[model samples]
Target: MAFVEGTGDEFILTCFVCKNPFGLVAQFCGYCQATRQQALGVERARASQQIISDEPEPQPVHNISSEVNTPAAERVKKQKPKRQNLFFQNMRLRLDNFKEWQIKRSKPIGATASALFIAFTYVVIQTYIFVNTAPTLDAEKYLYPAVTHEVSYFDASNSEPATAKTDIFPVKYLKWSASSSDRWTTKASWNGWTGKADITFTPAGNLETDRPVLAQFTAQYSTYWKVFRKITWEPASPAAILKLSYPNDKNLTIYFNGLAAGSISNPAVAAGSYQMYPGPFEIKFYNLNTGRLIDKYTRTYFISTSGVFSPSYQN
Candidate 1:
């Protein structure tokens, strides 16, 4: 490199870049306009471009066997089970939190849950006890079977059956048979329960015929139902009843089961109406003025629970 200023002289140098003669300047070649450093860089670039590169270029690293064995879709498939397991675990944790919250809500909530559990346990225990209790073949009246059944009866020489209406649900049919003088039985079976209806009669005597009477029927159970049954024992009705009108009270005296009931003539004779139970009663006729008994007859009779004794026997 050379420099000149205001010397009134012309000088020249050969350009290293273009190989042309150049006028003297401070830094650049005049012919090719290249600096010293630029010329060096261009020469190095040309030299490198001319050289033959025998070595291969670098590439990304990968396992060819692993890529072949495990495809992208198959790897994604393998990860699904793990994700599902995590989901289930999260759900269980949420459920546990919910359970804790419910139990901790209030005293009433806990108490209600405990009460329900206790009731269930009590019912289970009672069921076990009832089933395990002595198999005494106790009698039970199943309301469902009886309610669904329509029964007919013939009492005291009656020819026709009791009801004129047909059966609502004729799911069962049983033949009636006389078991004894005062009792009748029927063969009936339903819903895993099998038994006969044992009906007892009250010796019913007539108020009009005096010697003739209709039988009062009473039904009884034959077997115990030990499963899922609600039972309530009902009292048996009176076997007989006697009704006496007013004004005729003075002439009649009634006895129920050998016990003196009241006189129709008496002011306190149950308002001139005398009803009795157990049957086999006595009716005595008397004279009001003489206090002398005119006639007396003892007989056995009864009536239905809601019906008065009217001697309904027909033979």
Candidate 2:
């Protein structure tokens, strides 16, 4: 037997074996040995049936399109746009383009700058060489003057020394003749006596035309009466026949008293007897090609009253 009890809104059952109050679903009575196996069994069977009845019925299988339309499927199918990846690709493309532009722009500029640097260096080196190696002009050779002197003479009758006729003349100008016919000439005038004399310079046997010669002469003069004289020409001036020896005659430049007197070559020689003035003078030799001085000689040339030139080198 069982009895029911209410507690608030709930109900309880009393076990008939022990008169103990219990829940409606109690399996056994605690005070008495009694079991509710039949009722429990029936309850379990009903629960199983309820569970079977609560299961959903199977439906027909659907196509993929129907599954994709579901909310869960739609959520799974959506994808985020790869904006960061696109940005990286765009950056890489821009970097590659920038590198190409840099390469293209640098080629010609680098080449031009290198070429300009090379050209500037060459110019600087050349200028340095020229400044350091160029020759300078000799001042003493260019500024000194030729030698000169004055002369006086006499022609006498053997009667008395004091009674002998005297001629007072100053011969200052001297020149070497280039013409074969006019080997040398002396001009002197004093006290209304003016004269011109021609000299013949003949070289000794087998000697070159440039060698020192034995000089002889003849003169025509106005001395109160016209006088024609033939004699050995000996003047009070010091004299010498000069010739230059050079390795390259074509390139030689000879300076006399700082003046470009003449140039010489083989087969045609520079040979002359000079009656120089009595003073310091310069003789310089140069190579015209290089604008360089080859030789420099400074001398005091003495022209005696005997009309001869004797030169001595100072250095």
Candidate 3:
């Protein structure tokens, strides 16, 4: 039956005419101003009184006996559980069907055909889509977003691959030379300082030049350039790496050029650095626990002589 159920207090009653809870013991429903007796099904066929009425009037006297019901709010809450259960039932059925489809797809014949299809698709995408998709970038910024190129390189003689920070806008393509002896050297002359390569953004373009330049050089020493796509350019700076050799007794906070650079979270490692210019910089180490100055030094930093900017600890 559509009706409000009253709890504990007799003075407190919920008027079915408006579904508003009222604490007044009165003859009329306080909220809807309906005759309290008629709304409670105590009387029927009373003139439909209107006094700021927002709710439907209580069921007719004749219909009240068979179809009276609880408040709409309570009915909605009771239905939520049924709806949730039905939704979960449908979801479980879908998951089971998906599992069955996966099992069938894993059968030997299907699996082999699927694997071949996937392999062929991957090769095609790599050869055509990826190759053409890797839009050529200049020494400056890469073209915006539609396509990308992640240019990296490695020497055939060396195992480690070399990459540079692409986050730098308007890059001059100068730092990547640190990876090879001549980064762009094709001369028959192979030396310790000759990067055999130069700082260049033309990772794939190097192929054309590599042939003509290395024509005189030994083919035995080879370098490979690999380019890919999709990269997020984040803000970064040229960091001056300062390696510390002395073992520390406690964690120390480092300051560079009189500004707080960072703190040594791991006291065990004596080497790390901060982002600063390559020049004379003041370094001060303070006790992380007590904030007392320990070691202070003004170290002159310069790029290492090697083509690779190998950082050495300044004593």
Candidate 4:
């Protein structure tokens, strides 16, 4: 290369490495950008070596393969395997040639599975509702203790507060398979409880017909009024009793298993007509037994047109 004598302008040289336009001329043709960069590096190394002449160094030869190890460059040069969607193509081909029996059978199989699933669900739901809502025999077995429920009040002016004028309670009767004369009863002890009415009766007499037993209390108008609504008279345990209340002395009709037991007649029951003091009535039931009497229930009754309305209300 020769420089012009009068012109001070520098000549722009094309890159020999990649055959691209560059500022200075070089020994290597830079046909590729990476090769041009390598030529520039070699020139810089030569200049640095000339500056440090005291250091021992070997002269480097121009070898294209020794410039840089680029896996991407190797991949660009090498061939790549072609991709194929053979799995999807095969599935579509098989579906086109699928048998009629296989396709039709799938519907019934799906329907059967769905039906079985629905049936299983319904069974589970039904079981849950039955277990939770329905009464269990185990609980009924344990609830056999006799109890007496009482509700009554005495006038502050007339009698003692401890004594009730009338008691209203429910009764249960159990039939015993025996002769007419034989009978069994337990003492009227509370089922370990002071107030509700409950009893367990075992029949010693003939159960073919209703049995009649005497009650120590009398059933009056005022005694039948109160406890008619609040009673749960489930006739499960053999025999139970109801105590009646009264403001005045009166005759009471008694029923044993719906049969007439005995009526109590009194004359002092007439004075309770116009007295507004609690209407005067109480109720209770007792078991007539040889050893001990089982007191089933103790309840207070209120007067109503239909009947007593305390422990239970029945027209």
Candidate 5:
């Protein structure tokens, strides 16, 4: 039955000479089909041939079907032609276009996504630092050790912890008394004026001496050397005593000449040595307890009194 196939939707066309399905839905054999295509070209050339007025007109071929197809070919003439579905064809075109667009845009989309991710990461890191890291200063307690040194005061005020600016006053106003004859009565003092504000001193080293060197002052500033806002001092001798008496609470960092000494928590500091010479100092008074910076003085001075170099620090 396949040998007698027709070119219908359910039937396939077959070659008469080979007696096999041609696989193509056409009337002729494969070899014959090729020959027909070549003949069609020859026929088209012949039909286009025309002569000038002097030449005789060529006769056109009439009934060329008889010349191309023999009587026996009519018996194998196939029926029906295959048609493609319009919707499926359009869908294929759309899929092809979509694939092309994706290939072209993939790189830009990926780069944009990566940039957004990096930006987000930077924002997160900045937020973390803002929340956790603390600056190296607290101003309100710069000279008052009681406010900063007392934990209860900080708790009540709810202040942030601060870094110490080791340099307070440039001069060592409190010096060791060499004229002391009594081992328990020798004294120390300061002579600079603080304009309108009261001055105070905080010792950085040994406050005790060979003589009584009475550890008291005429005024509050005479006890506290606050002339040069930032200062340092060096001792000719190692056991030189320095005394700093803070009437109230404050936070301050004291340095021994050029070396880093330590922090002071006591309001009244006595019994210290040359290490008490707070020199090479810097001051930024930020009150961590109050969460603000106040007492912003910008003057610094160093002076020598009675063969002794002292620092007078100012706001």
Candidate 6:
């Protein structure tokens, strides 16, 4: 017998008649000189038959409806794990896209919100200042007209008006005017003396001294003339007169004891009277049309018996 080396599942076989496998290298058996092709063909047919016989027998097929109705067939059905994984992947992609979008828009959104808040706050503050802090025409009550008084004393013993003992009391709202204008003059008569006076006032003009000058006069005497010779322009009680000498002919508001007393407009003289007391008072001047504060005066004043408190200012 003879053998040969080979690879894989194939091997060179020896010829049975010659007992020689060297015939694989040639076309015939070396010892018996038989044809190798015929022998190889017979061996291949036998191997095929052996292989076919060794295979297991096929089982019979059952009815399709019966197999579907069985529980075991249902358990063998394919599970779609890939579909579940694809669904989760889509959800994750959407979440990532949303995160990227938020990051890109955050700066502009934040800046816009901040700018809006600042603008709103500024508008609110400006409105508050205009409504509350700015001056208004309703506050004109604090510029009321001031008060004034004139007092006179006469003596009957002297013959001439100049030589006669004459005492002129300081009167408020007393102003000087050119000799021609007869616009503001108050005339009154007592038992022994005739009184005539002129007051010139302009809030926007210069202030001039208003001293009383004696003119020609005749004296009349009666039984009660000596006792009743003193004449006063104020009430008999101890009250004080406040006089404001402003140069302009405009509307004014007066404040007494830090409270709004009243208002006055286009007066020849600005004057008012109050009960005689000592207290601190404030006076504020405002422009009637524009609602602006022009000037202010505050003082602690005392009012004695028959005293006049005169505060003067020019525009």
CA-only RMSD, every prediction: 17.3, 28.7, 31.5, 23.5, 26.6, 27.1
The backbone clash count of each candidate, in order, is 8, 20, 19, 90, 52, 17
Better candidate by lDDT, 4 or 6 = 6
Across residues 173-277, which tens digit of lDDT does each residue of candidate 5 receive? 323332222221111222222212122222322343321111111212122124212211111122112233221234553333223333345312232221222
TM-score of each: 0.26, 0.21, 0.20, 0.20, 0.17, 0.20
How far is 61's C-alpha from truth in model 5 (Å)? 58
Which candidate comes out best when scored by lDDT?
A: 6
How many clashing residue pairs are found in candidate 4? 90
Tens-place lDDT digits, model 6, residues 129-161: 333321111111111111122122221112234
The reply for model 2, stretches above 4 Å from the true place, is: 1-248, 266-269, 296-315
Point out where model 5 deviates above 4 Å.
Answer: 1-105, 124-128, 136-172, 175-315
Better of 2 and 4 by TM-score: 2
Once superposed on the true structure, which residue ranges of model 4 sit more than 4 Å away at CA? 1-73, 76-104, 134-138, 145-315
- lDDT values, one for every candidate: 0.37, 0.38, 0.38, 0.33, 0.33, 0.39
Give the TM-score (vs. native) of candidate 4: 0.20
Give lDDT for model 2. Answer: 0.38
Candidate 3 weakest lDDT stretch, 10 residues = 212-221
Highest TM-score: give the candidate number. Answer: 1
Kindly list the per-residue Cα lDDT of model 4 for residues 1-315, writing each as its tens digit.
Answer: 233443222334444234344435433433433333444444433332222223355566867775565466554555587786999889887887676556768988889999999988866654453333322222122222211111211121122233233322222221122212234342221211112223322234333343322111111112212422112222222122232333221234433333333433432222121212111134332333332222333343322111223333221
Q: List, residue by residue over 115-136, the lDDT tens digit for candidate 1.
A: 9999898677655643443212
Per-residue error for 76 in candidate 6, Å, reads: 99
Who is ahead in lDDT, 2 or 6? 6
For model 3, residues 96-202, the per-residue Cα lDDT tens digits are 99988888867876878999999887666544532332212321232111012122211111221222221211112122222232333222222212212222222
Model 2 — TM-score against the truth? 0.21
The C-alpha stretches of model 3 lying farther than 4 A from their native spots are 1-160, 163-246, 266-277, 280-282, 289-292, 296-298, 303-315
